[model samples]
Each structure stands twice: as structure tokens, then as C-alpha cells.
Target: MSSAAKRKLYLLKLSPEGNASLLGILQHPDGTVLKQLQPPPRGPREQEFYNKVYDSDCCDRILLELREYLPKYFGVWSPPTAPNDTYLKLEDVTRKFNKPCIMDVKIGQKSYDPYASAEKIQQQVSKYPLMEEIGFLVLGMRVYHVSSDSYETQNQHYGRSLTKETVKDGISKFFHSGYCLRKDVVAASIQKVEKILEWFEGQTQLNFYASSLLFVYEGSCQATTMRLSDVTLAEKRRVPKGLLSGGDVLEYNNNIHVINSTENGKIEASVGKGLSKFYALHKKSCSKRHHSQLSLKVENSEQDNVWKSSTCITQEHLNGNVLPQLEKVFYHMPAEPKESAKVEVRMIDFAHVFPSNTKDEGYIYGLKNLITVLQNILDN
Candidate 1:
């Protein structure tokens, strides 16, 4: 049996303090997550993005550079026992963190796609009117609090209530563990995102709407200071997949339960850089909750971006450093390097993307504003 097949599955469980957006996401001990394709245009659209990027023959310069900001893709998968239930077997972006403080912020002034009806547009606008002004909305968040030995979380409701003046504070809270405000981590995140902005500035291939930047950093201070090594990164993660599966996750709930998965835990074996989480939160309790999966808006149109048919990566990288003075700014290393990533800012949710001949200004505007907000936090 393939090692992936021999492995058991577990629900990717998040702490009650933190909310996850997707439903039916399963994780394995080997640092992979499986997201079931949802119905219709959304499923097809997202699958389409991954397919093109991972297309063995694909060499699009924009995509090649953009792939660095995305999670690794391993192609569509369906368990041998459940062929009818196909899934996108992807890398879990949060796998490396000992205590992952995750945030999903929907970017862009317009959340609705070009195809949105007036009613649909109004519904999105009504939820967060400031989306146009702020260019981003905090959809979900979970931050690890070190001193208290717990996690703190803020959901979409909290995101919508922030005023323009306090938006910086709202963002500051994410970088602040109860113990300290991590300016270093904030700085690193900014640097990473700056790279993404550079790509958007040059590309006219895709317009991203109703998408999110999934930010994650190691919340455990001890882990951050340890000088990460292959040996240290190999240390397991937090909780298993629900339905209860295998993983590096050693603890879950207030109570502690450790399961040392004997499965192949090597990071190298996992395909592509891990993907941002793909889940539509469904609370099955008395409250009975259902939400769109991080607002990756779906489109019914059959049009495809003409940019997909472009050239592949040459040895020198992305048509030879489009901005060399910016410091080899265009080179995209192969995804999933041997050294584990300590912090991440992944651009996720492609269902609402449109073909564009000019830059993705809306997404870029939000990114610039976000950088300013984060920078202020770091300064103060």
C-alpha cells in the first residue's frame, strides 16, 4: 500500500477557544490535510487553480513566483474505499507550529466577484461595510497565550466591530501573545508579505477577490527561540483530525492526550508546501452553525484566465529577476524545502479570481494598508 493509504485519518481539531472555518477536513500524522471538494463552481474553481499550478508542464512565470506564497498541492485524492468522495489532498500550513496562532483575514475592498448579484453584493457589504475602506476583514483568529498557557481567539463578529482608528489595535492583538507583543514575528510576517506584494505589482494575470491571507506563527516562545532545526521541526503538532485520526498533535482539550504516530512523519515526503486550511465551519451543537469557508466566493462563469498558457521557470528564475536591485526579487525556489518554515502568510481561496490585464489593485491596496497597520503596531 502507498504510505499515504496505509495511514489512518483524524479530524483536524482546533481548540474550542479557536474556531476553524472548514468542515470535513482530515489530517494525517504525516503533515497532510484532505479537504473534500464542495459543491459546484467553488469546488471546481479551487480545484482548477491547484491543477494549473501543479501542472507538470506548467511554467507560467507569474504562477511560478506566486506559488511561493501558496501551500503545496498533491493533486486530487479519494480514498480507495470512498472513490465517490473525492478530496484535494494538500499540505496543512499549520503543521509545523507547536502552538499555532492562526488568523484568516479576507482581503480586497470588494468581496463580491464580478458575477455577484446586487443582493449578494449588498449582503457582503452589509456584513462589513468597512471592507471597501479597510480592504480586509478578520474572518477568524486564534492566538496562543503563553503566560496563561491557553489560547485567545476572535471571530468574524469581532472583526466587523472594529473602527478605522482601532483596526491597528485589532491587528496588534494577533501578534501579542498574553506574555509579549512579538515585534520580531510581526516584522518577519511583514517581510514575507512584502514579497507577495512585489509579485502582485508586476502581474496582470489574476484578480483575487474575497480571498484571505492565512497568517500563522509559532505561539510557543520556547519553540521560537530554540533555533529551529530539522530535528526540532520534526517534533509533532497539537491535536489530531476529528472523527479522531493520527498526527504529531500531542495534546488536545484542557486534558492531555499524546499519541506518537509511528507513521511516516518525514516532512520531505509530503507534497507541495502545505496549503492554507480549507474548511467551512459547521457547528453541530445546539447552536447549529454553518458558514462559507473563509469566503472563497464561487463563480458560475466558464471563462478561464488566458495567463495559464505562459512559459515555465528557467534556471535563472522568473525571466531573470524582474527587479534585481530589489534583491533577486523574482526567484521562486521549489516549494517545500528541506528546512521547515517558521512563519507563513499564505494567499488562499481562489474561487472569486478574475482575469486581469492590469495589477490586482484591490488586493494590493489592502496589503499595503495592512503593512502600515502592522508596522505601526511594531513601532508602538
Candidate 2:
């Protein structure tokens, strides 16, 4: 038997709330199961199942009893939490290292049979929460194998329609965060199966927000695929349109071209002479045209510090000139310079104003000691 035939197969069963049950099937080189070990389950279960199985008072107790079975594949169990709680913590770990995480779900019919109505199975799996969380991010395929006993007797009787429905159901469930056996040939080796499962796990670790942001920047506008960055740059350079000498005209071919204020004595005519002409040309070129103008005047005042103020801009308005202007205004704000540094130091009150006070002095001295120790380590 070839080395590839000796790989392990995996079955990942995920509860509705995102807890996992992993079943690893070690396969012999001849495509036979060598051993099958159910992964220790994690997270809260139905009260009845918990009471009957572990006789534990709480979920944590059950987890403790099952601790020996964990850390066998994944290093530690990090249960799912709300986004804000998980983000910074996960960021801390991922900033220094990369790890693979796979996600899977189980699918079984009321008859305890692998083959079932595809549409029905899909509808059930679609309701799972984990499917909703990562649905847009992945595509899944189904693999099917029958129990040894059933495979021999039912092989000839199993119609192609059943196989097709099984495969379809499996894919639908897999897409909806559920897994089921399909008619597609299962990986001959258990190790190959485990590898596929691990691939999905790694995808789950990917930050969804970050990925979406990247997609927005990379995706095209309109039916035609054009680069977002290019569109933004073009918009930034667009010249405003206006009437020139009693006729509408376009002053610039693209936004990058600078309008000469005195090229044709055009500025003296109206509020937006050359710019209005540019807008007219733009309207003619694009399928849809809407024009609005905004003007702002700021008067210098010590009380009204525009430089330090924050402004709200919707994601749609974040491109073009607005983004660059905001960046320029905030360019000098104080920031931490080091990437590896943790714990930003800030005074609780006016420490500088009352430096000699006991509380202020104590804080200052404590900070000084902490910094000194950190500095010493770096120096050594």
C-alpha cells in the first residue's frame, strides 16, 4: 500500500453554538480504518445529555473531566466569544505566530442513515449559527462512505438519484456549517481527510473584518472590473464643471489636470465657471450624473481647535480627498512608536501639576521602576 493510502480520516461535529466534536480515523495503508477515536466534546450541551453522560453539575466540570482528551491536536481549547472580546486577544496571539484552525459540522438523519433528502438536510443545517458567521467566506464539498455492513448489501440497490441527493445535501450542509457523508468518494486515507479539515480550521482563524476591508479595496466598481485605487485617484483629480461664456464646457480631461486660474480669464465670470464646465463633461461621459457642492470656511480660534477634533465620515465617503485631508490633519498626533511594546502609559490625573503629592509621586515612581526594569532587559 502507498503512503497516501495510510492517511487518517476526520469527522468534525459542531454543535449549534459552535462547540466541536472531532473524530479521527486512523487508516491502514490498504484503505481500512486502523483506529477510531472520538474527539472530546467541548462547550455546553443539552441538560439531559449532560446529566446522563457526565453527571456533572456544570459545563466546566464536564470539560475538566475531558481535559485529558484535549490538547491532542489543537494546543488548547479557546472557546468562541463575542467579536470585541475575542479580537484583541486573538490579535495578541496571531501577531507573533500562525496556527491552523479547522471548523466542521455533523449531519445525520432521523433514521440513523447517511442517505437522506438533500433539501431537508440543507434546510436544517442552514439554521446553525456558525454557518451564518462564516457563510460568505467559504465553499464546501461533500464526501460519502457507507457503514461496512450496509455498503455490501445496499451497493447495488442504492440508485444514482440517492447518491446525487446525498452529495447535494452534504454540500449544502457543509456550506451551512454542517457536515454529512455524500456519494463523492471519501479520501482513501485518514491523514488526507484530517488535512482537509485542518484547512477549514485555518480559515476560521482569519479575521473576517480585515478580510472584508481588503476585498472592498480590491473589488471593482460597476459591471466592469476596474481597480478601486484607480477609481479613487481619478475622482480625487476630477475638475468641477460650470458654465463658461454662456455655454457649458468641460475644462479638464481628468482630475489630475490642474486648471489654470487665468488661462482664459474664466475665474471672473461666476462662482464655479471652469469647474461647472468640467462637471458638464463628466455628466456626459458617465451613465448617471448628480451634482452637489459643499464649501466650508474656518476661522482661527483658540477655543475651536479643528486640528485635534475628530469627524465622522461614512465608509462610502472615506475615499478620495476626504481621506487624505483627515490624514493630513491628524499627522502630528502623538502615537506609540514601537510595535512590540504593550501597555500604554497614561496618567490618571494631572500628575505633572501636583508632582510632589504622595499619590502622584507614587504613580510616577512606580512607572519609573517599571520602565527601568524593561529598559534593563533590553540593554542586557
lDDT of 1 by residue, 46-139 (tens): 8998888778888898888888898789887765444566678777786656667788888899999989999999999999999999999887
Off by over 4 Å in 1: 1-21, 223-250, 253-341
Output the number of the TM-score-best candidate: 1
Candidate closest to the true structure, highest lDDT: 1
C-alpha lDDT values of all predictions: 0.61, 0.21
How do the residues 8-47 of candidate 2 rate in per-residue lDDT, one tens digit apiece?
Answer: 2222222333332222222222233212211222112121
Per-candidate TM-scores read 0.66, 0.15
For model 2 the local lDDT of residue 54 reads 40
Report how far off residue 185 is in candidate 2 (Å): 19
